[model samples]
Target: MKDHLSALVQKANLGDREALEQVLLKIKDLVYNLSLKMLLFPEDAKDATQEILIKVVTHLSTFNHKSQFKTWVYRIATNYLLNHKGKRSKEFAMPFKDYTDLIDLGHSNEVRYTKNEGELSLLEEEVKVSCTQGLLLCLNEIDRMVYILTDILGFNGVEGSEILGISSENYRQKLSRSRAKVRSFLNNKCGLVNPENPCRCTKKIDFLIDQKIVNPKDLRFAHFSDRSIDLVGRIDDLEKSVAIYRSTPNFPAPEELLEEIKTTLKIN
Candidate 1:
């Protein structure tokens, strides 16, 4: 696939319209999924994905063949995410205790429940997704990106370093710190990490439902067809164990949006 994409990049740089479109299509999901994880909002992710694709298209000619085309594209996307000014406040930096406190505050109101097992399961999934995403956000930008690329997205150290314009050793060091931090937090606060942990997704379902953070009717993270991270094999190692929660579903770009991007680029 990388070789094919590199060939497409060669054609795209020469202004072959079909090749340009194909190139954009090839990386659309990657840009969107990364933006979604970083931004933690669908609309923001969509807008960012569009903007990143436009940048990629406009700058296609500057791409040298020294690196893989996909790596170049990822460099563009990751740089944009790291430096792009966000309209939304960075409210995700609070400590785990603070996050739970905020949730408890949201649970002040009393609400009735008539949810079935399926509905309850959906809510639990949402909680897990939301909390894990939140944990990612708590890390500093570089650490967060390293964790996302190496642990969550399953990129190797070399690829991750290339994407971020860093050394492989540096990427590994950052990843190690990130893993330790995440594992520590999960071990202390998440029941999935340790049965002895006081926090349980099941226990949070009512609070989330009452706060309308996890609506059965409007399921956010659970609606995607992509496999959940928890289904991955559980390892005894803490870093590997925590990685199970970091994996996210691939979020594909809508066909309509892809077409719109092609149109904007005036690609056939």
Candidate 2:
């Protein structure tokens, strides 16, 4: 697939409209999923994915074969996300201290029951996704990225360092610290990770719905597809706390975004 994408990249750099669109189709989901993980909101992720794809399209010629084309795309996407000052970025910016405090205070402690078991299961999935993604907001952008790439995505230190343009040693150090931080919180607080933990996704659904943090009518992350992080990557190899995140649904980029980009670039 990489070789095929490389062939398309060559054609795209030479201004082949069809090849360019094909290239966009290939990378859109990857960029969108990364943006979604980082931004935590579907709308914000869509906007970020659009910008990242545009960057990939406009900057196609600048991609020398020094790295894999996918790596180049990752570089551009990560650069934009790390520096992005979008609304969610500002809203979620806070220290771990404040974040943990919010988690402790946010729960209603009473589990809400739905008549249908399926409905209850869906709400539980919603809370699971929302809370875990929200936990990422506590880390600084760099740590968050490192944790996502190395821990959740199962990238090795060398590959992670290459993607982030940091030394492997530095990458390892950051991964260790970030992993420990996220893992510690999950171990102590998330019931999915530790059954003994007081916090349960089932118990939080009613409170989340009442507060409008989650809507049963419109779930953002649950039921997207059976395609999960574990299916895409090696989740079992990771620590249990981090492995819980692998159950998250991997969202696809909106198909219309590709057509809009083509229109903007006048590719057709």
Number of the predicted model whose TM-score against the real structure is largest:
2
In candidate 1, stretches whose alpha carbon ends up further than 4 angstroms from where it belongs are 100-112, 225-240
Q: Which stretches of candidate 2 lie over 4 Å from their true place?
A: 106-113, 225-236
Q: What is candidate 1's lDDT per residue for 1-268, written digit by digit as tens?
A: 8789989999878878888888888899989888877777666778888999999999989988898887888899999988764454164456656765754443322224544776555666777787677667677778888888877787999889988988889999999999888887776666676677667666666677776656767766876734353554354453544555544467676567788887786767
Predicted candidate 2 versus true structure: per-residue lDDT over 127-180, tens digit per residue: 778888888878888988998887777788998899999999999988888888
Model 1 global lDDT (CA atoms, 0 to 1)? 0.74
Q: What is the C-alpha local distance difference test score of each model? A: 0.74, 0.82
Kindly report the root-mean-square deviation of model 1 from the true structure over all alpha carbons: 3.1
lDDT of 2: 0.82
TM-scores for the candidates: 0.85, 0.92
